[model samples]
Target: MNIAFQDSKDIDKEQVMKLYNDVGWYAYTKDASTLNNALRASLDVISAWDGEELVGLIRVVGDGLTILYIQDILVLNAYQNQGVATQLMEQVMQKYEHVRQKVLLTEEASDVRHFYEKNGFASCDKGSLVAFAKLEG
Candidate 1:
């Protein structure tokens, strides 16, 4: 499909909401304006486009030097199983190769776990690091 990646937050608001909704990220889509602001404030935002169509997105937030946390990464349901996500991840990893710590949290599914591990991340259980979070849904 000739997916193209843009390393910028210059995406359209409607497209952003749809991309999030396409992957069932209802929480993020609850408020378009708030989400847009979140994207604008991210440490970095990478989007995957297919001929002007938004197919996927990966967003990060962190201090550029010490820690880089991948806040979100999602591909449209129809675009899953292709190399789009892998490429998006590879680009992020490449850009932050020098960052002290890189992190992301995902569902406890086997495939999801494998995806991150395949992209060069180890689980907190496998390392000395432990992660914690408190969220209101």
Candidate 2:
């Protein structure tokens, strides 16, 4: 598979929505315009493409100095076992190599943990760090 990566946020909204939906992230896809706007506003966006297909993407939001929060990293189901997500993350890591803090919040699943761990992320509990979130009602 010939995969190309780009640091771009001007992706097609329909393609972004389709990718999110295919990954079962219906909550993000529910409001296409809002999702598109968020993507546009992100500090960084790295996307993977197999020929013309949008197979994976990783996005960040941060001040580009002290902290960089990985807002999203996803690969299409068919492309999961491949290194698409890893490549996307590598791009993010390389871009922010000097940043002190890199953070992400994701679902609690063994595979999810393993994936992030393999990519150099540590569990908050392991680091004695705490995380909290407030979901809108």
Summarize candidate 2's per-residue lDDT along 105-127 as a digit string, tens digits. Answer: 99999999999999999999786
Angstrom error at residue 114, model 1 = 0.7
CA lDDT of each prediction against the hidden true structure:
0.91, 0.93
Stretch of 10 with least lDDT, candidate 2: 128-137
| Candidate 2 segments whose C-alpha is farther than 4 A from its true place | none
Please tell me which predicted candidate would have the highest lDDT against the true structure: 2
TM-score of each candidate? 0.96, 0.97
The C-alpha local distance difference test score for the whole of candidate 1 amounts to: 0.91
Q: Mind giving the per-residue lDDT tens digits that candidate 1 earns over 1-137?
A: 79988999989999998999988889889988899999999999999999989999899999978899999999999999898889999998889889989988888989999999898899998869899988886
Residue 137 of model 2, lDDT score: 42
